[model samples]
Target: MAERAAEKAYYRFLVLFFNCLLTFGSYFCFDIPSVLQEQFQGNLSCPNGTHYNGTGHNGTTECVEGLGMTPEEYNLLYAIYAWTNALVVIVAGFLIDKLGNRFGVFVFSFLTVLGSSVFALGSHFRGTPYLLPLMLTGRLLFGSGNGSLTIVQNRITAIWFKGKELALAFGLTLSFSRLGSVLNFFFTQQFESRFGIQWTLWGGTLLCVLGFVSAVTVSVLDKVGMKQLGLDGVIQQESKKVRVQDVRQLPLRYWLLVLTIMFFYNGVFPFVADASKFIQDKYPGYSQREAAYIAGAVYDSSLILSAAIGILIDYVGLRGLFAVGCAVLTLPAFALLAFTFVPPLVSTIWLGITYSFAAASMWPSIPLVVPQATLGTAMGLATSVQMIGIGLSNVIVGKILGTKSSELKIPLWRWQNMMVFMLANTIACIIVAVSLNIIDKKEGGTLNRSTKRSPTEQVAGQPADTASLLNDVDDERSIN
Candidate 1:
């Protein structure tokens, strides 16, 4: 009894630790760019006491003089980052399957630490043209770690939680990650103002180190928990003999649900990175630092609301609840973009609220459709598809902003274009939601028929050997 209690405590600790580690890393996803802009400002310091009018150490300078890159260049860089994340998710599926979640998390966390350190070092030596390559290299490595960590988080959650509790767990985990984003909003600039951009990057490096330590601790706790539960050896042996079977296959409806998530993320993730500068450009009165604060609030607020909505998904079911959430989210997103000429503060706040509602519903619904054994693969595929949308949207928004002019013939700034792009993306999401509802109904009908069929008809429909393979897959999953 003592051992069992100790084991339960360990499992709880493992879940909390992994959730914190992943959330810390997610915060850095947006933090790095803000740090980069600060470093760019320091590097592009004026040559003399006489300040260059547009190139002075002010809010716009970070975007114009510091980065040296035009809007198009920055967009391309962001696309690369998004694409790298997508590839990492796809690769991590196989890596977790082979290495197990513990080993995979450790290896990936170590890579993140290294990548962040390199990025910090590169920021300090920005005079060298080589810094760009080094920074990109670091981002690529970090992306891999990010992908691996995502897969591991979902797998671990599926293992430790069940039913509606799992949805809450997932939602709460996301909420912590949003907390990181909130920290990034205020702290990144504060760090840059205090020590320098290098120190800011170093801060992320330190977080990565902490993540590595937490991952190792979780691995140890996981072993203890498994042994106490009498599942350690059983899981290992079963993993070796595991095979893909028809019953284990995810339905097409599941893929549609994933697609909806992909569309939502496509708008949200890139916006997190780009919105600060975009807002500053559009509003003009607000400083970049102020914009960053608002942007963080926007992202973090959604996470807070999402946790509540995630619980709602458990009671309401995905088909109607998620679809309605997506539909409602579109209204604010479109309103913000369509009224671009108006004061943006109100719209920004509304957009933030809408986004939170959609996200809270969408992410929690994934595990309901996919079983544990194949959860990693399903999430990987879903994330990869999301990245594709993110990458494309970044480029498209960049082009639209860089090329188009407003009604007055003034060139529409990048941020304004981004808002327009987000509005359009939200509209696309509505269509995806409608399609998903249709697919869900069809899948439900099919499952009902399959379950109600006579035993002889079920046996005759599939060969005896194939039916046995299906049973084995289900049995192994049930053993958990």
Candidate 2:
């Protein structure tokens, strides 16, 4: 029995580790162009275009250094991804539920790798007329895979962690995934500085290949666990097939939660996507390296604290209260970044805290309200809605910032558009979160229960369920 337990433990950790790796490449590659914003926007190649002063700390923004693309073109790279995923994720979710997350993971991971290669290929021919078209094409593919894989991650995570440590597992996965974002911000510049644009991008693409490998490994591990550990019933229960008609059964709170997710994410992710350039435009005195690292703090702080916050919420079970708090905290962060010249680190740290807090709390709440059978479809619907907000936000942001003249020494006006959009979203989030909390209370406080199960609740070392790899955990928890 001890040996059997050890095997289970081993498979569990391995699957979780590889599952976390599945998103690393996608996150890292997503932000590459933003990190190299200057390089991509440059009109001239770096052979003599833009260079560090003799001190190696300051760069001449006066020099145009890379592909001669306008700001609107630069922002299109991100907007395309959001637009494509707004629809694809819903279909992907249904497929995951009908088929299984394991297949979803492998297939989408491959799509990301393919997308990365396409993106790299586009960047390789920097001077060609085809450059922008190729790049946008690449982003479209990448977005489809990235959004779908995220749903897969959530579904599999629900199955694997279930009632116990669900929040922490999410936090850990988030921390690991965001680590890619952090790395891209910090290293993409360094890679470009040493290797030039084409190679640096291809280097990031190589990481996508690694993510695909991890996906393959995780699928194998998941399959092995099912066979060796008697987890077939668990898989069937958690990932049971469902039809579109079943979506009508999702609760009112789920829709509210989806609204909250949509509004809340719009404030954060689009901000991050454009952060590096936003920093340089606001603080012209800083080097690209400084701007990139400062931008990175938004993700770095989350990577450091997300799991710890998850553990706390798991033990205490006040995710709704924390959800409200998370939205509230973001208000000031957006306020400071938009209005004051105060050091950006303060605002970024605040945004990071809120991002980590919500990652731990708001997301795990989805399983509580939605039935297990349709969790995939539910996640898909939420993600589709979330992408709609993000996509529209990106389009708005691109339009506002894209038209600005590159001649300005400091474009202070740049922050206002993002701030107005984010502030409005935060206000919306606060209202929605409050509603979710009130309604959750009326619905018996399902989201407020500690996820820890009593010994009496254990059955076959996993939560028992119906149409739910996720519901069994919910089944054992009482609202009181």
Candidate 3:
């Protein structure tokens, strides 16, 4: 019993429990607009084409039960989140590396609390002129906090689980974080129906408080583990002052990984942002609630399946090949969504499967290619680039949809046009994934090495040739 009490694996997973909760609030609040699109756009029907004249099915928008924002305004909420993260996350990364992820977690989580509060306030004043501005501000804060919190989470994972179960750890984090998104889609509409919109919005703020408490808990657990393991100095020592030049030192392989995420997520996330409304537009039978459920399949499927794929990638090796295959699959997934009249559930599932596979392979690959000292910076850089792409994509989508809301139903042709853009982005993502595979092979396949192949290896070493991150720096700093 004493032996088990002292086990590092036991404590590590304890920390993982709270680590997974760190970003829950941001994700939960992030997609509120997507699920609430019709109401916010001044329509009162479940299906998009339910034109009512106050008595029956008349050929006019009812405009009774939402905030009445335009389509451009609806999409701008998402754009603000992405844009804020694009500007702030890179700097936040450097600071996390310099100050330590223990503290970084608190800072980012606190930001979420503040942001969510302001957002609730915005919703509270829904009829005022301040509504849009406050909402944008709240999203701005939430985006920065969530984005930086992700950087810290990735860095924390590397610090604690590096060279062992790294991919699985990452998969767990993704599954857990996205659980927030899944819950939002599942419950936001229900909450609004039961307790009114203001209370529903406040619920997100309450979740942010949970996130903050979890952040503090994980930090305490991590510090205790470091002391027990005698690595407090090692962590602090390696996490030294970072320089802007360090960004340039990140390898070409790392940059390629960044490129893969940039193009790939542009297809997935922007779509998720608008998926509920999209489903309502194309499919005739589903209600808004049912459409929200179908849209959330992207996260729900991933929540259940990504950990299994992570375990597979952890043992199977060949992550690059896995990435290539996943990227290629998204092409057909988007094609079916774009051109065919088949049920959208099938395409959503296809997307979720491919996303789970690719994420399990891709994110863990970052620690393999770069030294620990630069991990936070690399993550931040990648996140910033991704935010830029996603933000612009939201804007571009807004432009495509235009500001017309007579019937609240976008034509099938416009839906196809949007899918075409996603398909093109997915094609680029596949090209880059292929490029990443070719480049990784030429460079000794560090990313393709599996831990199962090295049963005798120590926990301190990686699956392949990794730089001696701790040794290169003074004994004063560690990636912790």
TM-scores, in order shown?
A: 0.82, 0.91, 0.91
Candidate 1 lDDT tens digits, 1-480? 767853454556456566556547645644567434423433244355212122223434421224344455555656766688788886676556545778777887787787777766766555568767777777777766776677777777656654324455666777777777777887777666656566777888887887788788778776777666666665566456434452247777677777777777667666766666555555556655676777776656666676686565544445345555665565675466456556555655666676666655665556556654556667777777887788888788668756331111124454555666776676777777777777666645221122123435434543321122224434667896
Per-residue accuracy of model 3 over 25-97 as CA lDDT, tens digit each? 7788878777777766754334555331211134233444556577888889889899899999999998888
| Cα deviation of 78, candidate 2, in Å | 1.1
**Which portions of model 3 miss their true places by more than 4 Å?**
1-7, 43-64, 404-407, 455-480
Candidate 1 lowest-lDDT run of ten: 403-412
Would you list the C-alpha lDDT of every candidate in the order shown? Answer: 0.61, 0.80, 0.80
What is the lDDT for 123 in model 1?
66
- Quote model 1's TM-score: 0.82
Which digits, one per residue and each the tens of the lDDT, describe model 2 over residues 1-480? Answer: 643551455656667899999999899999998788777777655566566321122433456567766777777788789888888999999999888878899889988988888888898677788898898888989999999999999887887776667888899899989999999988888888888888987888899898899888888877766655555565566565578998888888899889988889999988887777777667546677888888889899999999899889888888888989999989999998898888887888889989999888988888777767788888999989999898888878878775554331335686677788889999999999999889988876767766675534433332322123434433544442
What is the alpha-carbon lDDT of model 2 when measured against the actual structure?
0.80
Given candidate 3, what's the lDDT at residue 463? 28
